[model samples]
Target: FQFCSTRHELGSIILTTNLDFDKWPDVFGDARMTEALIDRLTHRADIHVMNGESYRFRQTLELRKRVAKEN
Candidate 1:
């Protein structure tokens, strides 16, 4: 929180997480802290919620199917 509060304006940061803003407290284990952290992080951020199965998992299944066909 300290780094973000001080350095957020210095540059952009990229983060990936499955949890929504409302669920952040579950991960942080502190509602107040999560609120503060979210406030700072979202102040100048582009929030994108990605939905569905992970790309890597889908690709792995495709690879396995192809290998099975060849064998």
Candidate 2:
């Protein structure tokens, strides 16, 4: 959390991670480290759980070009 810590003592910081906070232990390795790290993070922060596709699969530039050609 080098990046997050930089923002600490300043104001709120946002974590737009593909991995959930619950999975952070496995992601970071060492649950204790994860706990301590997240503890500092949660002291005054907003946690948003966002899940969705890759976006490219839903809408692509190739498809947009083809649609434009038809028009």
Candidate number achieving the greatest lDDT relative to the actual structure: 1
Estimate, for each residue in 1-71, the C-alpha lDDT of model 1 and write its tens digit.
77877777788777788778899898879999889888888986889887889999999999999999999
| TM-score of every candidate relative to the true structure | 0.77, 0.59
Per-prediction CA RMSD (Å): 1.8, 3.9
lDDT of 2 by residue, 1-71 (tens): 66666677677776677776789999888898788788889887777775677678667877888899999
lDDT of 1: 0.85
* Lowest summed lDDT window (length 10), candidate 1: 4-13
Regions of model 2 farther than 4 Å from truth: 1-6, 52-56, 61-71
Q: Model 2 reaches what TM-score against the true structure?
A: 0.59
Off by over 4 Å in 1: none
